[model samples]
Each structure stands twice: as structure tokens, then as C-alpha cells.
Target: MDMINGYLEALPEEERTPDPLYRERLDVCETCSRLQNGLCAVCGCFVLYRAGKTSSECPCGLW
Candidate 1:
């Protein structure tokens, strides 16, 4: 459910990051203590979708 919501909330395609960058961001999110399940414990955002958006960023300053 969170994954679907994340994708739905992602920035428009024109503003999204490349696949590689998105994955890199996901990797960073996966290792963070703030990530809970598929969401960010800090902001309660879906890491997958959030990471895919070039306009978005880690609230923790990891990215």
C-alpha cells in the first residue's frame, strides 16, 4: 500500500531522477535507521517514491 502511494505521489515524470540515481537513493534509505517498513520514520514518506524524485531529498541530509 505504501509503495503504491509512493509511486502515485512521485513527481511528474519530467522531473524524476534516472533509474540508477533512484536506486542509489533507495539504497541509502534502506540503510537508514529512520526508515520504517517502506516509509521514512522521520517524515513518514515512502522512500521508494521519494527517492525517485530528483526534486526531493533525504530529510536526514544523507543524499
Candidate 2:
């Protein structure tokens, strides 16, 4: 997806997850079919961005 067309709703700084946790989640998303580039087709959020959110969930339940 284009930068302007991607999910712009970012999690507040306080709600973002720690680097390690995000990295772990990203590992899973990377191998998932629902993941495209860094974006999640199910949630329309970048895998890095979405994985960084403590509250964000993987629609495919892989994360």
C-alpha cells in the first residue's frame, strides 16, 4: 500500500510495546500470508506498526 493510503492511526507512545516484543510478533507476521511487505492485509496496519502496539491483534491469530 502507498504511504498515504496505509493505516495512519498510530498507537500512542505509552501504548506501544517494547522493541523485543514487537520484534517477536514481527517474526510471526513475516511468515504469514496475511502479511504483505510490512503491512497486514487483515488489519490494514503495517506489521511493524501493528506489532508495536500492545493492544493490536492479528486477525489471523498468528501473533
Candidate 3:
């Protein structure tokens, strides 16, 4: 979790997703079957990390 937080903190403010959208993206991930141990099975990425970036997209195209 700390690693993911660090990655998020490293992103420029403009490149970070807005709080509301990030939360929304997380909410979507929460309901996805591809979510496993906080990671996205489709792309092998931490959902928290992936959702934090403004340019990131869900591998399953849910986001």
C-alpha cells in the first residue's frame, strides 16, 4: 500500500485523477470480477495505482 501511495504521490498534480473520479473508478473496481487482492487481474496492476493516474484506463474497459 505504501508503494502505491508513493507512486501516486510521484505523479504531477495535473496528471493525477480528480478525487471524485478516482473514487468513482475505485467503486467500479470494487464491483469488478477482475479485482483480486487489490489488483486488476486483466492487466496485472494494482487497482489503486492504476486508478490514481489520470491517463490510466481499466484493462477491461470499465473505466
Candidate 4:
């Protein structure tokens, strides 16, 4: 899984946005990951692209 994680890690931070609707969209993706944004919204694992530490990171691949 390191390849997958690394691929995610190398993404640019600008790719992430703090839109409130993104959170709601995250919830929806939990059931089905159909979002074209290419983020793991259910687990918020995409936060790694933002290039900083967040509370959500510890439990996911962000570490």
C-alpha cells in the first residue's frame, strides 16, 4: 500500500479545498466513492494533499 500512499502523498497541497460542501460530499462518498475529485472523503485521507498535520490524519494514511 505504500505505493498508493506515496502516490497520494506526492499530490500538491493546492489540490485540497476547505469547502463546507466537501465535508457533506465526503459523507455521501462513504457509501459510494463516486466523486471525481479523487479524495477519500469518508476517511478524510485526502487531507495529506494539503501538506500539513490535521486531527484527521492520525487514523489514516496521512501519518
Maximum-TM-score candidate = 3
RMSD of each: 2.7, 4.1, 0.8, 11.1
The number of the candidate with the highest lDDT is 3
lDDT tens per residue, model 4, 1-63: 465457645655554434464454445444453333645554554533322322233233322
* lDDT of the candidates, in the order given: 0.80, 0.72, 0.93, 0.42
The lDDT, on a scale of 0 to 1, for candidate 2 is 0.72
Candidate 2, residues 1-63: lDDT per residue as tens digits?
355223323545677877788778978987888777677888787776667678888887776
Question: Is 1 or 3 the stronger prediction by TM-score?
Answer: 3
lDDT of 3 by residue, 1-63 (tens): 898889999999998999999999999999998889998888998999999999999977899
TM-score of 1: 0.78
What value of lDDT does candidate 1 attain over all alpha carbons?
A: 0.80
Candidates, ranked, TM-score: 3, 1, 2, 4
What are the TM-scores, per candidate, against the unseen true structure? 0.78, 0.69, 0.93, 0.28
**Candidate 4 — which residues are off by over 4 angstroms?**
1-3, 17-23, 32-63
Q: Candidate 2 — which pairs collide?
A: none
Model 4: colliding residue pairs:
none
Candidate 1 lDDT for residue 16: 83
Model 4 has a clash total of 0
Question: Alpha carbon lDDT of residue 54, candidate 2?
Answer: 80
Candidate 1 structure quality by residue, lDDT tens digits, 9-55 = 66577778788887889889888889888899887888877777788
Q: How good is model 4 by TM-score?
A: 0.28
